[model samples]
Target: MGSAVSSAAFSTRPGLLDGLDPEQLAAASAPRGPVCVLAGAGTGKTRTITHRIAHLIQSGHVAAGQVLAVTFTARAAGEMRARLRGLGVDGAQALTFHAAARRQLRYFWPRVVGDRLWDLLEGKLRLVAQAANRAGVATEAEVLRDLASEIEWAKATLVSPDDYPAVAARTQRDTPAPAAQVAEVYRNYEKIKNSAQVLDFDDLLLHTTAVLEEHGDVATEFRDRYRCFVVDEYQDVTPLQQRLLNAWLGGRDDLTVVGDANQTIYSFGGASPRPLLEFTRRFPEATVVRLERDYRSTPQVVSLANKVIGAARGRPAGSRLQLIGQRPDGPEPRFAEYDDEPAEAVAVAGRIRQLLDAGVPASQIAVLYRVNAQSEAYEQALSELDIPYLVRGGERFFARKEVRQAISALRVATSRPSGADVVEQVRTALAGVGLTEQPPPGGAAKERWDALLSLVELAEELAATVQDADLARYVAELEQRAAAQHPPTVEGVTLASLHAAKGLEWDAVFLVGLAEGTVPIQHADGDDSAIEEERRLFYVGVTRAREHLSLTWALSRNAGGRRHRRRSRFLYGLIPEDHPAARVARAQGKTFGGATARCRVCGGGLTATLEVKLGRCARCPSNVDEELLERLKSWRSDRSRELKVPPFVVFTDATLVAIAEQRPADDGALVSISGIGATKLERFGAEVLAVVRAAGRG
Candidate 1:
């Protein structure tokens, strides 16, 4: 029995380097000091990092608590910690860059500044708007939001207000506002934040770096505490983060960085792959290892991803790491074309239903697109089909407007320096916000209320664990928890943007809206570097599949009433002329030229006049009452005129057809149709249904 027990236990515990390829093993076992791992997509980068940490600990080179592992997202950090636990290691400092800085600030704040840390300013845009107003700059919400983004970009790149115009001219980057105007707003915004005595998220890293640089003892303490560092997605490191990392290292070269230059897609957010590209120059003796073996995607998908990456220019010459797929051969990726966006969404939804029917778990599939706005049609289609799906990278729970408002109120009530009981302070904050009453009836409002209530419950639980139960301490913990929170892992299909889908994989993946303007993204029109990053974004999407993959695009968009679109240029180069997928896409495009232009509403054949310009077919016999249909058209036309956009932008003719056919009486029923989502439903549901009721009476 003892021998059998020992065998089972040993079987459960995998060896540190059991399944790693030779290159990965080399990376994991390399001597310490400035190691760089150029890991391609689907390569076992995470595995290599985890194994390396375990090896270091098991070999008695470093204690678990002394190693700091940083990743780009909370999900990645949690996965690293879990993997370490499985490897019989714990208490390691696995966190995001912001989380690590926040911890350091909390630890050294008293020693450096001799006071409690100020609250983090969550209303950054609001403050920017106020500053813009005071500075006599345009205070339009859109302008403020753009300027706020510019401010963030400036800080991340360590550009000061005085240097804004010179930097903008040097880079030849376009700004939504004039460079001088943006500079004015940035200066005023800083003055306002300083007057308010609050630090924004960026200020956490800035302040921590300041503390470390100005105080030798604190810097020494941190360096002694964390002797080794491992940074994941090192290509996306911004200058500010690099400076902070350097401060923590105290000029030591004990760092392991893993990234792929081909996957650096966040240049717009002030990230650069230059650090990863120049690692060898910075540390001449650095050991460099490349992991080319892809363990996530099948051979076909891997081939396509490599082809996409090959088209990218401006990469370090001869430094591109091509991925070799290890997963078994699977179906060649499907390329589907549709007449319009709505129809494309319908077809994709049908395929998802089929996959689920074939016993594939809903959680094993994802539908990825270029922008968040592209998710509406897919969300509507999935909801109509009753397939459970989760939309990632939307307003996160903590970042929602309603949640922010509640948190702001809580901050006000707890901002006092007096030592108040945590539970009482939280109760007072909830009561102050008028959340003491029952939650309101609307779905969104109810969710907001539940989030606040959950915070209250958390405070009570926290109070039991600490002495004195200070509200400030509770708030600090709350902020830390929010930073590390991941989207709840409900069983559902994931709908995410390509940027959000990095480091994630699905058994079956759908890449949608691969049109020229959408994939290269309209902003990237004439810029070579931006286009290359777009191609890298496409590569990221392609490599997310393990078995099945589909690349889809529409011939025209429904929003602007049938503006024609071409296939993405990246696809044109990546899919060779003789390739079967290319041929399939071309063949699919041919179906639209015949006399078979179908009704966007019901998919019925349209007569010649109706077929022209995609008009509705009278002979098809509308399921919608004729009067109701006319009224919806009138409402859409008026809204289009009010918004100064095309009529279809308000509600496409196809969506009207769906609404008429369904005759939804309420918001719940109205949102069930394709093309109608929360925003549209909230904007037009009452009026649309009022028209339906009048028609019913008529």
Candidate 2:
């Protein structure tokens, strides 16, 4: 009550405890000492944590500048900052562990290290390659990549090269090479990186930890600067990250963390739910709150999600969240058994079509699968039906460098106090930074340009679609995106891997390719822990649906093929035998493990149809911008027809690609394209620029 934020300003913000459920209110109000909020899927974890920070600042317990909130992703951090601003609090630092560490490293490296810090490598591959060569380990590009991941895992788990061989063997890690060879490569990598004075992302935390552990003054300053700390996704903290966090905290205990142990799906990436599960052990007096209400999904969807996770074996005792659905009742989840993969994809797409026709926005529908390979069939089926869709890859969206840089610029501009509208402010901030009208044909430079252009379009959209929108409002929208992992509503259905579907929700969700080997995944076959993770993944997918939820599995890989596949084991005890799902599987054929397949119902011997993802999946760009670039291309396509010339004649693919990537909106911009001279600009500049302008206006 004694904080700088006056009662008048705080009253208008209903999000601070006023709107919180009882459990959230308890977690948010207990803004002192150690607090752990066990947030379930679909629960308002972001809301609760943001409100807790707001309450701490607004109620005078902590100043906004003294509080630090950390999440796992840039977008999530952005989301927290936006929400705090909405609650009339500002100046708090909400960032990913890497972002926070990098900020500190940038500031203190000179003072602590007595010189500038080493260049942080954007990627580890080039360095890993050199290390492989130095260590006499011959590797192709793919093998190099796998080794890079192995190195990352070792670093994340705080394992040294000396530790990796034993650790990998102990954990049964599927090493790309023999454990000893991989460890040798890892050692060479460290030696090379040190010699070159370069550090990879994981090293960012390692170096920071070393600095703090080795330097007293820097650690003191960091701890003083951030008195109160909040960490989101506590379940997914790698051991290296926890070390960095501990270094930041020094000996302080003013911390709050939110996570669900049951949602621990990133063990392969060195994330464990142990920190969340054992929070009370470290701080015996810690206030632990469990958020069970499922606010994002219908009761039907929530019940199914709860059921799915309920069957998971070997889960830590009391770790699972028994979700209590809070939304109005919706239809029971639908289950289907297809004769083949093609039939399943077609059936899923057909139902999606019906849902789209009935008025569910394409953006509110998603087809979630276990692995990227399963997407091909759905992609073909959706394309055949003339449905627009996005196939999501692995990389986190807001973690892109261009996006982070653009946001940093926006923040700087916001601090200066701009006179222009939100969109204009963004454009001015990004003017020469990357949002040029013309751009390169390919590579990172073009990707950077496209990211900035998308931000501009996002600003334009907010300015037009929102009432009296400003930079603050635009930031808030980004916050919403960060909180949900939902990008701006693209005008297409989303096809994402289940891991990609975490922290996101939809009105209609179709979970496809739920056969045994695909769902539990072949790698999980021998490991109980890995199998449990797969079950958690299934729970994540189930909870994403708000209304219509259809789950399908193929009995075979091809039409009229041997019915050797079986439904996911996770689905077995969840869906009843009398259900159409089980009936259909029974009618086709039921097969579990081994080459010899037997029908579950009739005891008939059947041939096998292998379900594979890792071996069969195709690879593609892991990061794609869903921005005005796509819209500009679509508009350019229309112009191609109206000009009464072939599309290429109107503008070569290179020029058009440039136009789309740059989102050029003026004559100067158009003429700068590779093939677009003054003549072409005179002919089609208005048309091309108009698309960018329209995209800006939403």
Identify the candidate with maximal TM-score.
1
lDDT of 2 by residue, 597-665 (tens): 343234454332221110111121212224666775676578767744345445544444455555566
- Per-prediction TM-score, please? 0.76, 0.74
Tens-digit lDDT track of model 1 for 140-216 = 88888888999999999999999998998899868967888888889999999998889888899899999999999
- In the predicted model 1, the residue pairs found to clash are none
Alpha-carbon error at 75 in model 2, in Å? Answer: 2.2
Local lDDT at 152 for model 2: 90
Model 1 lDDT-worst window of ten:
1-10
- Clash pairs, candidate 2, are 79-479
